[model samples]
Target chain A: MIDMFRRRFISVMVILLLIISGCNNRQETSSTNEAGDQVITIRAQTFGDEQTRIQNLEEAAKELNEQLKAENKKIQVKLETSSFDGSWEEYRRQFILAFKSKNEPDIFLTGHEDIAWLAKGDYILPLDELKDSEAYRDVYPTLWESVTWNGHIWGALQDTEARPIFYRKDVLKQLGWTDEEIESLPEKVKNGEFTVDDMTRVAKEAIDQGLVQWGILHRPVNGPEFHMIAKNFGAQLYDPKEDKLVFDKEAILESLRYFESLTQKEKVTPESMTSMEWKNVHQMMIDGKALFWYGGIWNIFNYMDQGAEFDYLMENFGFTLVPATEKGGTPMTLSHPIVHTVSSQTVHPDLVIRLLELVAKPEYQAKHSVETFHLPIHERGSEVEQFKNDEFLSQITYMLDYTTFLPNHADFNKYGDAYFNAIQSVEIGKKTPEEALKDMEVQIQNDLGDTIIIK
Target chain B: MKKWVLPYLMLTPFLLLVLLFFVTPVVITTIMAFTNMDYSMEWNFIGLQNFEKIVSDPNFSQIVFNTFIYVGFTLLINVFFALLLALLSSYYIPFEQSGLFFRALWMLPRITPPVVYVLLWLWIFDASEYGLLNTLTSFFFSNDPIAWLIDHPMTAIILVNGMVGASFGMIIFSSAIQSIPRDLFKAAQVDGASEWSVFKDIILPSIKWPIMFVTVWQLLSLLTSYEYILLLTDGGPVFESEVWPLYSYHKAFKNLEFGYGSALSLILVIIAILLTGVLLKLFKFNRMIQSSRIE
Candidate 1:
């Protein structure tokens, strides 16, 4: 009896110990140090190539701390920043999981498109109170639409980029195009004189003449660039009043047809192009093996990182908006703005907003923009010397005038997946454009139900 | 009660581990399947809507078909190739260390990180003119580069997965083959039996249990495994290579439909149970587990 009692007691104690250890004690967000200084630690995170997005917040904290010290306040602020270099899907999933667990950082950076989902989920705090703040007054009015959902602003714009179709000038030259014609391509695209079909024709001709090994190379994965191309083909992505995503069937069909022609009919893009590695695609472009790359302005940095000198890129490549789908139609570019959001679980919402405002200041924005090769969020950012003096920034800034944004809807990812799958099906000859479109319609309707408008 | 205490105490750690890792996740997943959980992470109960969605999914049939093909063909390669290697290394090879050397070489793919392993395959089958395969073809035949992955996604995934999977079976079968008594082989030689007849009559019956274990084990592994497929084809060039588990993963994590994803996974669990039962019965598991009549 004594031995049995001892065994039972030990088992109970072990179980109780496990339970105690498994339960976490929430840490105090702010603490007082021995020096009588109240220390506030704010954790921040950003994803992808946006390290400067969080680093700028760290810099802003330094300035804010100095001001507090000057004002004789007993408070000190410390910013804990992390930048993830993984894919956006993984990053967003981590943030969502962290939020669900009540362990999310005080502030984080994400694409503006995520604002709708985050706001709907109540995972983030609304910044409507800052709508009239002086810090946000100079922000470009167009970018404001991207962060607003359900009549409330949820985040501050961190940075923006324009997706451009980069072309190899040397390949065009080898195909008997004169320097004057090559230099005028962007202007022609901007004025709607050059069409997407014309671009395909040129690529095909280049492939036929053996001037380039392949005609066009695109990202081998699903991304916002496909949406930009679809927009050029006249796909209406969202309805603001209804707050619903639109399928725009005919326009999507045209987009699929375009990809099919490129990969199958024209034979300009490889059927295996969708399965290629990202690094190889960039290398192909850098080697001038491809006549065109449906890529982004940020790729300029990627090229430089891969040993392609800035001068060489400038001398060998030309970039323009995705050309018009038809003659006399508008060319389009896409800007996927990354934004700074405050978690709803934050203890210091006001301080977080203040830090974000400091980070949003024109000079800080210009510095980040110049270093990362992304465009500024406001006109004043261009006035800063770093942005003003950069030749590439100056040249690419005009593309923003024609830029479009992905719809800020919670289910936009579903639409994008269906859209991309259809493109793949068409490109690989598994289905015709009509069949792929039919499949896409069935898929979106089943997945999203009444949340989407199929036209 | 005193007698029972020690045994229960001894079993406590393993039972606690099972409760923590296995039971908790299964319970949570089962509960989640009934809720309309999404990126919002809300627990609003929605009953069978998720299961209904799975049944109605257009890709459901195609994914199921892909899963069967992947498991079936990969299992064939894994089991047969492993049996061949085990027999050769343990029985036929003149020098044992050389056989061990070849076995160790085969084990490299199993030990390499999945990402690195998949990357090597990607380089080998790259569609571009500069890919390793393409470089060789261009050098020897002066032919244009062929798109190995795009043209034949299923074959690539099967071979990649099979190569890694075969090593596991080889290890199990080799040990089993090595354990068979030398008296059986010497007896067969004294009876003037040919090597092929001896293999058929002695070796085949000696390792029946291991063969059955490998088949059932590999079938279950293949049914659930998707990391290699995820890295290699990501179920694409279209849905030509998509499997059920990958589809479930893409739905839950990629598409952020947690509830629906849970439902898909729950269905997979059910299918796995049924298939496991059938496999065990087909392999005569009860008979194999029974004590030998000779003993």
Candidate 2:
């Protein structure tokens, strides 16, 4: 009887302990050290290949701490940083889960396109107070438009890059193109003198002449590049008056038909191009096996990291805007600007904003741009010597004039997925462009419900 | 009441754990299926709307068909192939250590991390002249490089998942075969039973319970698993290799349609329960649990 009582007692104790642990919700926002100084630890996370997004914040923390000391404040800010170099979808999902769990970082860097979703989810703070600050005075007006959603500024623009159609000049030369023609291609594309059909014809000729094995290569995965192509074909992505995403069927059909012709009719691009790895795509471009690559300016740094000399890249490769869909049509590029957002769960909102302001300085932004090969968010960054002297950066900066942005609608991801799935279907010969577009319409309507305008 | 207290105390911890991990999530998911939760994560209930959307989805039929094919074929490979290997190593093979080595070789896929295993498959089937399969085809048959994953997504995923899944059944079946009394085999041989006859009447009967367990277990597992498929094909080239679980995940996490994803998951749970019930009846699980005739 005594042993039985002891067993019951132990079981009760285990249950009580578990319940106590489950109820423990201790969260340390700040701590005081033995010196009686308040040490504030601010955690920050940034996604994708731009490590400078968070690294620059760490540097800014130092400046902020010194400024605090100058103001006779008793606080020292310690910034802890983490980066995820994976797909943006996975990164955003992680952040959303973190927010739901109430353990989100004080600051996170993501695409400006996610502003609407993040703001709606209440995962980020509205930095409308910082909009009039002196630090943001020099930022480009267009970039400011990107970080604003629902009449409030949601995040601070970090950096942007132009998506360009990169081509191998040597391949064009081998196919009997003159140096003059090679140099004039960008100008021709910009002015709509060169159409997408003409680009396809050229790619097909290169393949026929055995100068290149493949005509054009694109990102194997879904990305802003597809939306850029859709916009080039005249798809209006958003209805601002209605505040709904637009599914422009005619324009999307044209874009899907274009991809179909490239894979099915032209026979220059492989049917399995969508399944290839990003590394393989880069290797094909570097090895000159492909004539044109629908890529981004950041790829220049990627190529350099892969051991291709900058001089070699300049001599061998050339970049131009995505050609017009038809004669006398407008040429275009896309800018997916990364933005730094303060989490709503943060205990140090003011300190986080101050650190972000320091990180946004022209000198620091320019340094990050020069190191990462991304374009600066403001005009003053152009005055920085490093950004001013970069030949590639100087050249690509003009493309931003014709640049477009993905819609800031919360349901834009669903629309983008439908668009990418249509492209994949057409390229794989699983469906005609018409069928793919019809299927996409159904998918979009099903996913977005009344949130999207199916035109 | 006093007599029941000790047993209840012993069972308390396990019941609490089940309540915490299993019951709570299921209850939450059932409730979420009726909500319109999206990126905002709000639980705004809209009854049957998500289910209506699922029924109206254009890819619904194709996704269902793909899941059927994936689960059906993978279950076959997981059960029969595993049984074959177990029989060869434990009963048929003359050399014991060689059999053990062969079993270990099959276990490698199960032991390797899913990412590394998928990476190896990717390297082998890459749609380029440099891929291992393409290289071999080029060298031996002088053939052009074939896009293996894109052209045959179902086959690639089924084989990858099946190879890993078979190892689990292999371990279980091998143990069951080894536990059979040695004297029965000797008696069968003395009675002039041929090797094939011995396998048919004696060995097969002895391992019936193991076979039944493996079949039902692998079927349930295959219905829910999509990691290998996600890593390999991502349910693409179209929805060719996409299964139900992957579709649920894409809807929930990828599209941020948490409520709809929950609805999809709830349907999958119902289907799994029905399938399990049918399988258990077909296997005569009640009979298997009854006392053996000899005892």
Candidate 3:
């Protein structure tokens, strides 16, 4: 009788362990609080440098409060923000996690072109119904279409991206490249006369002259940073029509072959080039270690914030938008619009809509753009007197005239990452370009399934 | 009635905590993994699917290898250095009371905020061509500076983590050795035993249980320690030194795939438990000496 009971107890304990272990998963998470008052507390989150997030929140809250008071409404409006902006990936995830709760913010910013995915997944509210009456559609025929997912528009623009190569005028001046030479360089680069071959030669010349060791270093490990350059080289990333990941294996192969040549063949760029991320490259330029840096327009303020005088840096610095292929096309400037999206779960979506409408106004957008130190793509990008007059901003605006966005499909982030990793592998010699691209195609077909065409 | 009642009462809190913190989440995550738990914004549960999806993910293999390399390398070095320090510190040299102060100081690096240490390592292991070690090499030795973390991440993180873990091993071994009877060593010495013989037969046997305990405990710790790597590399330059813990964290937080992250964590816990069991079994010392019944 005793032995029987002991065995029974042990078996029960084992069964209980299995049962409890099964219960430990996240599927069991329930709603936080019972649904409450219907007042739309539309919440939005945006990340910036520490001080910038705080300032953005404070200003946004103030504006929201003013609008609420003017409406004589009882619906409460709250915006929660922090200056503790962690990594972009962390911030994005936290926002997504927050959405799981009943108390999630009603609105948020999606900086990547994959706003379509959030909409497809139903995290972001579709804005296509609002498109008919929306005055902002006049900016471009495809401006809103880029954010559309499953035949519904989802995201709205807050700001877009512009990248131009900041160069060392001192080195170029010493090379006897005249004003004529400087002005014609972008055109030459577009015409294929100035290939990565030419860029490598310049880097080599700079190294040999002891002018600088790093001639041109973008964020070497930056996935998006490389994509920006890749698309410019006429490397088609995906076939949206076929919904497949199509890496122009030949084009990407050519690009990576050239990318590695800078390190292996030309010996102009350092082997540590793979280790230096975007911020490091920008800093290296400011610290006078590198002669050229290709990055977003935001670097202008970042340098100024670092105590680098704008005028002092400008004397020996000028910029040109990275040119497109030697195919005489508009140099592709890769941009992803940061859009202010309304939440489907928001209580006061109408009020939130009003706020977005207010901010989307040219004057409000211009002021916010000036404060944000970013190039806003709407009328705000051109109308801001500060940007129009500032020499650096002037150059940046010129770069924006022929800009392109990263692919915005739901699976584009995954596809973009695969493309990047494959190229990085070849560039680092972990795999040859042909081998990497072939493997990438197989993997993409497996993982992405009909999401991207494998060509 | 009383016998069953008290036992039930005693088990309540532990059982509740296990349910709340561990069991419940594991169950939920397993269920979630089958379905897509992108976020609460869009949650759908599908079954055995999450496991299949994760196992088949292209990154799953390299991530696993990197994780094992990072954890295994750190645990081995930490245990080895710790044993060495513990053995050496047991000596009663002149002015040796200062070893206590030195041990405490040795713990300083570990006590310092990981964020601060990460920054210091950034300077020390900078991939910049002219970064610290590189600068030193260029100025003093005439060799190009090494890219510490990027190219050789496993070694870099192992050294940083092992150095921090040394003091822990030292403290445990020192106390455990101190508890042993001094007469044992005297008896071995009186028998004309060589130092190596004395160490192997007397000292080593005496500290076996403590060594096993330390190894098991450090295995658990080293496997979960993602700080040095997180602050330094962020699983980057193509996920070189991303251990299972960092991979789980990135999956949940960076990728916004909580269900998958939870599944990855389950695997990590299993690995940790298995490693602990293996450590204990390998040692053959079940527990501390119960008054030395050596036959």
Candidate 4:
């Protein structure tokens, strides 16, 4: 019996060993056989779920290879691109893990918010020489602010979107506003004539009159929308001189107070609004249950997919920057731009930048802009016929002129996450603004230590 | 000599595996706990700093409290529902083979992929009239759809975790109940004893080992498990539902503070081991190692 058991165990162990070893044989073989031909394989990863970014990458490789073949350089560039459909948090988590393993992509596409961490970790390469290229000048100058860290240009702007405060003109009209008044709402907001308090009052009136089911709706989850609201209250999240995250106590308190008042005081928003899923928030606004929705320009495309026509949207909805906290204050919107960076481990930095140059061309950017509904990064690209004829793009492109990006700090996530929790506590009536603000300060201080300035 | 050498050689794989997968990681984690390793992967010796940070933070207390509530309630619900369902199906149910069908149905939530399972729960608790619970509640009670996750996040998470966990114990208890000798049950019944007495005397004692086995196994699992809770709530509504393991994950992966996260995980491992010891002592594990009562 002992002998039989031993034989069985030995065979089973051998089979398991073979099975486990087989799983590790996944590395691709290099094609180095041809006598005078060299292949530079570039592996790239994009956070975008859309295939357009990958297609653009492949096109750059194909274009580069064709030029190289014409020059008889005997070199070919192969670009392998992978796109992620998971949440941005998951993508960042996976990328960080891969970077730690030294198994990262040669070129990585990530949000500009990741620049501080990636640069600080020395995981990415700085593109100082690219500053002299036309490809660098092709993008809007202000967008470079997002990708700059420690006085170095760390990434190329891949794409951007401007978040807008969308309001239903029909709801305002139903509340007995004049047609001219509805038409001038964007300008009113632009000149700070329509302040946040004015928005709250209007939402309240709409609610009282039953013109809309909800007064004002924003994103349910933690996102850049909170930054837009904070900016309206004159809050700056980062101080460049000190190179530290700014926790301006008064500004954060005011912002938290405003958000709390929206739900608990003015009753413009649902108490459960903070807990809502992303889709329900979108569905409510598109279904016209909201008087004002703080959303992105991409929401127009989403509404179109939800069966709303452009004409109908133009007739019923008006878009503007989120209003300032007070009259005559500067009105601003938020822009979250994704950027492309070369890995420090990459061998072909020149070819990578060359690929980014192809991607930044006006024609290529316009194609991406039209397909993805993202704003054109190139200033002259907006003049292209495809971009010029798009009424939505034309109208909201002015937001680019006054947009603010999130602070590029490694600890920005910690700071923003704590602030989000503070606002959530206030929104849910679990804590007052005073209490929540104190809690937020303590949380940030604990998480970020003295790296953050709590003024 | 050949027989002895062959047996030792056959045992080598299991011993090597334990060293490679389990012991190696624990050793590395202990080493990492003392270093200020993060996203940069620079192993700077920062002795006691990570532990000091964890102990000094106020949120640490709340996180511990939340973890206890989550594990305690979830364990109670898992064991209660599992044992109750097993008893009902085995003895009370009128049909002969229907008990197996009911037990299989209970396993459905366990068999489903965790992500898909949590997503289905998200839809059910969606905070809008479109959600299933909201639609049903609005029709019956004339009340708006409640944000189940927000209003009762602890309950929502406990229920989500408990419902899936109950199936594990239910299957174990069912088999243990079926293993009770038919003669023992019939002899008790012939003595004019009530069904309750027969169950109390014959069924309960026979399945004590399975009950202990499932309890200890589930306690260890629930103490470390955070998947359903992570997916369902992501420890949201302002850290109200954040447990230790999920908090450690967020610290290490999301915040890129791997040193702090490693310290947190080491603490979790120690706590899990301590709890397992207490449970072993409580369950009289030595009694299990002794000869069987039937013999």
Best lDDT goes to which candidate?
1
Each prediction's fraction of true contacts recovered: 0.65, 0.62, 0.31, 0.62
1 versus 4: better DockQ goes to: 1
Name the top TM-score candidate: 1
lDDT of 1 by residue, B197-230 (tens): 9888888888888888899889888888799999
1 versus 3: better DockQ goes to: 1
Model 3 fnat?
Answer: 0.31
Model 1: runs farther than 4 Å from truth? A1-25, B293-295
Candidate with more favorable, higher TM-score: 2 or 4: 2
Q: Candidate 3 lDDT, tens digit per residue, A123-215?
A: 767776556645464344445645665566776666665777777777776766897786677667656566555666787888888878677
Candidate number with the higher DockQ (3 or 4): 4
Shift of residue A55 alpha carbon in model 2, Å: 1.8
Over the stretch A132-189, how does candidate 4's per-residue lDDT look in tens digits?
A: 7887676777888888888898988878889989999888888999999998988998
Worst 10 residues of 2 chain B by lDDT: B286-295
- Score chain B of each candidate by TM-score: 0.96, 0.97, 0.86, 0.95
Worst 10 residues of 2 chain A by lDDT: A20-29
DockQ of 2: 0.59
Q: What DockQ does each candidate score versus the true complex, computed on alpha carbons?
A: 0.67, 0.59, 0.26, 0.48
Write the candidate numbers in order of decreasing DockQ. Answer: 1, 2, 4, 3
